[model samples]
Structure formats: C-alpha cells, structure tokens
Target: MHVVVIGSGIAGATCAESLAVAWRNQPEHRITLLSASPMLKTVANFHQLSRTLETFEIVERWLDDALQYPNLSIVHATVASVDTRAKSVLDTAGRRHAYDKLCVCAGARPNLIATAHPEHVIGIRDTESVKDLQARLGSARRVVVVGNGGIALELVHEVQFCDVVWAVRDEHIGTSFFDAGAATFFMSDVKLESAGMSENESTATLRHGLPEEPEETENGVAIFTPHTLQQRAAKAALASARAGVSDIPSSQAPPEPNQTAPAMEVYSGAALGPRWQDQARLHPIGERIDTPRRVVELSTSVSAVLSPAEFVAYRQQHPAIVHNDTDILDWPAIVVLSNNRVYGCDVVVSATGVVPCADFIGPEILRASDGGIAVNDQMQTNLPDVFAAGDVCTVQWPTSSHWFQLRLWTQARQMGAYAARCIQAAAKHELALLDFCFEAFAHVTRFFGFKVVLLGLYNAQGLAVGDYEVLLRVTRGHEYIKLVLANGCVQGAVLIGETDLEETFENLILNQLDVSAFKDMLLDPDVDVEDYFD
Candidate 1:
C-alpha cells in the first residue's frame, strides 16, 4: 500500500507520523510526505491539558531530521493538481506520483482584503509572508491593522515603537474568540501589555532562529530559509514556459492576456502554526514612546486601499484624518474605512481570515460552504480512498452539543491523528469510532499576556440571546472568568489568566453534572469548586 500526503504542515506531518509509527513493522507499505517548502513543521513536547485540549510547541525541522522514518520519504515539490481519476498527483515539475491512498492536507491561504495591491497590503500566513511584513515595518512610521481575528489581536499588542491604526468591523476587538464582556476585560490589559515576547517565544527564537540565507554544510545539513529569488524565478520561468507565455520582467507581472496562469501561480509555502510571530519580528522602527501608540477604530472595515498618488486626489473629494495633516503626504499608502474616515500609513496588514487552499483540488470533490473540502466522521472525503484533514478540510459530521469546529492548531492536530487511525482501520476492514477529542471543544491560547482556556461552546456560540445565564468572576488586570449555564448544567466557560479551573471545568462540561445546587459557588474564589463534587 502507498499513501501520499500533500503537505508537511501540522495536519499532514502528524498524520504521516502516526501512520509511520503504526506501520513501522510492515515494511511493504510506503508513505510519502510532499511539501512545497523544505522545512516541515513538527509538534514537539506535547502536553494533553484535558481530554479535548492539548498543547504543543511547533518545531521546524529540515530534511536531515525528517528522514528518521525508514518507510517514509519526504519530497519537496509544489503540487500542481490532483487527478483523482488517474490516482496520481502532478507536480509543477511535470512529474506524476502515483498513490493508492491520498490525503490532501494542503492547508489554507490568508484572505487578504486588498488583493490588487500586494506590495503595500500584506497578509501574515507563513514564515515567508511574516518576514516580508517585518522588512516593510523596519522603515514604517505608521501601520494599519485590519481584522478582528487572532492575528489582528496579536499584532495590535505585539507591535511597538510606531503608531498602529487598528480597524475592526465589530464594536469590540477579538470578535472571533471573545464576547463583548471578555473583550472589555482584556481591553484593560491591552493598554499596559508589554512589548517583549513571552518566555516560551524567547526560547523558541534562541533555539530555532531562522537564517537570512540557507547555510549548507559539507554533510548536507542546512539552516532553513525562504526560497531565494533565483529559485523563485526558476520556478516562475518553468511555470511561464509551461503556459507558453514569455517571461515577464517585473516581479509582480500580470498573466498574459486571456492566458490561463500556470498551476504553480497560486502556490504558496506551508501555513505557519503556533509561535510563528515569536520568530517573525514585528517591532517597528522608531524610538520608544511612554504613552500607548494605538488608535482604535471600531465598527469599520477597509473600504478601499489606495496609493499615495490616489490618496492625494481622493482627499480633494473626501476627508482624511491624521495627527499631523502636513506629514500625510509622506505615507506610502492610504486606507479609507467604511465610516468615511481615511488614514495615511506605510503598510496595511490584513488578518481578516483564511480561505482553504483547494484551488488544486478538482471539482469532483465536494466542498463545504466555507470552501474547504468536506470530510465525514472517518476523515474520508466524498471520493473513496481519498482523505483530508486540517484547515484544508471541514468536518461535515453531526457534531456533539458542546463540540464545534474551528480553524485552530489543537483541532488540526486532533484531526490529523484521527485521520491516520481511520485510514489504518479502513485498510484493515475494521470500524473506527469517533475520537473522544471531538466530545467537546477545548482550546488554550494567550491574549494580552494572560493564559486563556476556552472549553465547550465558549462565548455561547450558537446559543440564543438571553437563553443561557452567565456568571462572571473578574479581578481587574489579573483574571477574568465567565461561565455559561443552561438548565442547571454548566454548558460552556471562558477562563482567562492562571485560574487553574480548566480541569474541573472540562470535567463539568463533559460529565454534564447538575451543578445548580452550587452554581453560584462556581465563581467563588475562596471555595474549592473541585472539592464540592469530590
């Protein structure tokens, strides 16, 4: 049996590792890991925080360490398309790789607001894109961050020494993760948040610092770096030649009139995972300022992205706002928000959301409304012998009451491992039950320098307004806890800071115990909530 995994991201890597370990004794079976970039993301030092929540550090390893499996082989190539009828994948290099089973973990791409202006409008998705943003920020005096997602939230907090114009469509920040109350609670800390990286981030920087250029040793070990210009040009030339079009001189060339672009035209490196911002420096170039350096513009979105020349003409017909109106001309670009306000800035970072990278996937495969390939409970796609996991795939099964799908690393890792098990079971003609991890939704992340743990319908997702009761325990600048209760049972919770209530809360959600007797005591800091039921 042969399995071809199309991506070396967290999902693909985890699935590959699981299969390799399960089939280590079976030498006949072969596994192939395909990646566009040479560097493969691997999960390390994994810790299961709860039944549904797991935490791990993402470690980027080169080919040297990736070749540990004897039965598995890693191929660094960009896939052009997958021919389900032929049971093969065609790479940009015009090579066909045949496989008995296929897993499309191709991951996702950033949904940039301004697709036309790539130079001034940036979307941070991977190591390459983040590096590009860092370069532009080096000389930037002001930057506009647009989005209400995690990337936008983190960028607004991490960036220092330069003014940031944070534009959000929602009235409050972090609409994706937090409710209005939670957002307001975090807002208190946002003003005083430190510019320094977290301790884990500092260690990751020291341990796996990326180099400016690839440094290959005599033994073949090399420090990983972004694709060089020469390599990129060669790929572009190959693609252009395949399309029968002349090579364009400009780096950002448009496709030949009426000519279809090559398959590799939309290709990108692997999607970045946890701690990506740690290594990708976001500090803007300027002297440190004692006061906060951010302007929050709520309930607005970017209506248009304009160059300086366009902005000069635009200001005559519209209005532009800046602290120093005289220096507005110095900005490289101008952003016009939906609220009729305009601001001039050097760069605009769009962290809006992501669209699944399913362009290479054929139309025969069924896709969800969100554009990701839809998969069943077994992680099997609509086509037999084809599977998909991670951000590239959406779970189409009937989910548990408290569990839901989100494009998060925790869910990605879980889906990958479970997909491997399903594949193994299918090969053996056995049944694979839904994994317990899907019983409830749990995620652990950080925001505003505080530990955040979300479990089981956090933020009252999908619940009707005023249908559920909420309880809160807050300590200004320290901790914030919110619990969702319905019908005398704990339905969901948002625990922030070092509250140490995750274990008990997780059990409460899973067990669905009637806590109505002590519901009020759940938020009592003095009382041991865990001991009440014990």
Candidate 2:
C-alpha cells in the first residue's frame, strides 16, 4: 500500500507522522511525502490545557530530521497538477508519482487586498515574506495596516519606530476574535493618538502597543523581563552543544540520532504560523524621537493604494487634504481608506486573511462555496482513493451544534490527525467514527500578550438571531470572559488572560448543563464556578 501526501505544513506533516506511527511495524506500507519547500512544520512543546483546549509551538524542522521513520521518503518539488483519473500527481519537474491513496494538504495563501500597486503592498505568509518585511521596516517612518484578524492585531501591537494607521472594517478592533465589549476591554489600555497632531494636543504617549496584562502582576505593577534575544541564543547554544557541534548556529542544528541527513533548500517552505515575528527582528532602523503613533479607523477598509507618483499628484491636487506630514510624497504607498481618509506610508500591510490553495486541484473534485476542496465526514473528497485536509479542504458534512469551521492552526492539526485515522479505516474497508475534536470548536492563542482560549461557538457562530444570551466578566486590564447561553445552557465561551475557566466551561458546553437558576452567579468572583458545577 502506497500513501502520498502533499505539502509539509502542519496538516501534511501531522497526517504523515500519524500514519507512520500507526504503521511503523508494517514495512510493506510505503509513505511518500511531497513538499514544495524543504522545511517541515512540526508541533513542539504541546500541552493539553483542558479536554478540548491545547497549546503548542510551531517549529520549522529540517526535512532530514522529519524523516525519522524508516518507511517514509520525502520528495522536494512544487506540485504542478493532480490527475485524479490516473491516480497520480505531476510535479513541476514533470515527474508523475503514482499512489494508491493521495491526500492533498496544500495549505492556503494570504488573501491580499486587490491593489493596483502590488510592490507597495506586503502580506505576511511565510518566513521569507516576514524577513522581507523586516528588511523593509528598517527605514520606514509610517505604515498603513489593513484587517481586523489576529495577524493585524499582532502587527499593530508589535510594530515599533514607525507610526501605524490601522484600517479596520469592523466597528471595533479584533472583530475576528472579540465582540465590541470584549474589544473595548482589550483596547482600554491602548493610548490612541491622532496623526500629525501638535505636541500640546497629543497626550503623553503610553506604550506604543496594547498594555500587557501579565498574570503575575496587577494592573499598574511593574515587572522586569529577560531579554528574548539572549535567551534564544542560549537555547541555540545548548542545542548545538548537545549535538556535539561547538559554536554552531541554531539554524544548523544537527539531525536526530540514527537519521540520514538530506540536502534541502532553506526558507522556501509553506507559511509560518503564530509567532513567526519572533524569528525576525521587526524593529525599525535608527533611534526613534517620539513614541510611535497608532491611529485606529473603525468601520473602514483600504479603498485604494496609490503609487508615490500618484500620491504626489493627488497631494498636489488636494493640498488641503489632511495628512500626517508635509513631505507625504516621500512615502512609497499612499493608502486611501473607504472613509475618505488618506495616509502616506513606507508600505501597506494586508493582513486581511487567507484563502485555500485549490487551483491545482482538478475539476472532478468538489469544492465548497469558499473555494476549499469539499470533504465529507470521513475527510474523503468526492473522488475515491483521494482525500484532503488542512486549510485546503472544507468540511461539507453537518457538524456538531457548537462546532463550525475556522481556518486556524489548531483545526489544521486536528483535521490532519483525524484524516489519517479515516484513511487507515478506509484502507481496510471499515467505517471510522468522527473524532471527538469535531464535537466542539476549540482554539488557544495569544493576543496582546494575553492567553486566549476559545471553545464551541465562541462568537455565537451559526446560532439563530436572538436565540442566545451573552454574559461578560471584565477585570479592566486583567482578564475578559464572555459566555454564550442558549435555552439556559452554556453553548460557547471566550476566556482571555488567566481565567482558569476553560476546563469547567468545556464541560458546560459539551454536557449542555442548564445553569438557569445560577446564571447571574456564573461570573461572580467570590463563587467557585468549578466547585459549584462539580
């Protein structure tokens, strides 16, 4: 039996690894992993925080180290197309690899804003793109950021030395993760400063980004933190020393024991998720004079991106138009917002979101309305002996009442592992039960230095209008918790900061317990909600 998997992202890597673990003793079962780039994304330091909540770090492991299993072989080449009829996939090198079973785990690409000036717009996707952005930020004085997703939120917070103009379509920031009230809670500490304002008019600038709500300290308390660069270097040195390689860089860390090293290119892999910015220096060049300014334009989007020449012409035509500085023509890109506001900046970052990479797939395979390859409950596509997982595929089957689709890393990992089990069952002509992960929606992430856990219909997704009630508990700068209740039962929740309510709430959502009698006491600080439920 031959199994072929495409892409080396979290989904592909997890699926391939799960298959190898399940069939390690079966030498006859051959597994071949095809990747466009050499780097393979692996989950490291995974911790099961609760029944449905998990947290992990995404590490870019070399392809050589990833081939830890004897029965697996990796091919490095971009996939040209898939021929479902021939049961084979053609690579860019014109070589066709035949397979008894094939799984397409090719992930999504950033869905960038349609702009006439492509060079002026940058999208954060892979390591290379991030490095490129870091290089560009060296001399930037101002930048325009577009989107309301996690990426946009992170960018607005992390970016220093350059003024940032945040253009969001939603009424409040971080609409993708938090509602207006929750958004207010997070942004409460964020000091908003208008661009091009006089020193007297501008309030004393607080921190350049959102205030950190450290778990160990109260709101106004101060704590010293270790230097991240020195810590990273120490870790790298330790790894090299353990590998018997003295003074070696972390990027050149040795392969695992008993594994043969394979030659591969660097930084050509799929998109890097989560804390990719940590790997690169995002600080702008030169010493900053004043605190960097952040302007939030709510309920607005980037209507157009003008080139330097176009911006100069427009500025000349509309001399009275409000702008940050007099020398606006120096900026490479001038972003025109939907609300008729304009800002000239060094570059425009479109952190909008991503779309599935399904163009290479043939027409025989069914696709969802969102352009993702459609798959049933078994993770199998319309065609036989073929499957799809990760961001490239969408669940077409009816999901759990509390579960819905969100193109997140956690879901990618879950779907990949579950798809492998489904594949194994299909190979033996047996039915496989749906994994419990599909029973509810669960996600763990960090935003503005606060740990965030989302479970079930956290945003009341897919629920009927006026069918659910929401409850919120906010500690100003400490934590924010929101619960969605329907029919007197907990349906979803958003737990931010060190709430310690994930386990109990996960049960509440899963068990659908009626808390009508004690609904008001759910957020009572004095009440032990967990003990009450127990």
lDDT of 2: 0.74
Residue pairs clashing in model 1 are none
lDDT of 1 by residue, 1-534 (tens): 999999888899999999999999999888998888878888998998777778898888885688489889899888989999989999989988999889988888777774446678887777778888888887777789877777777788788767788876654467668665577677655652211234443222222212224432212222111233234335434533442223334211112122122233454666777666777777655554445467666556677778778777877777543333466667778787765667788899977777788788779999998788999999999998999999999899999999988888888888899999998998888768999999998999887678889999876777765466666666768887877877778888889899989989999999999987767678777788877765
Model 1 bad stretches (over 4 Å): 192-267, 284-292, 319-324
The ten-residue window of minimal lDDT in model 2 covers 250-259
Model 2 quality (TM-score): 0.85
Model-by-model lDDT, in order?
A: 0.74, 0.74
Deviation in Å, model 1, residue 313 alpha carbon:
2.4
For each of the candidates, the C-alpha root-mean-square deviation to the true structure, in angstroms, is 15.8, 13.5
Mark the 10 consecutive residues where model 1 has the least summed lDDT.
250-259
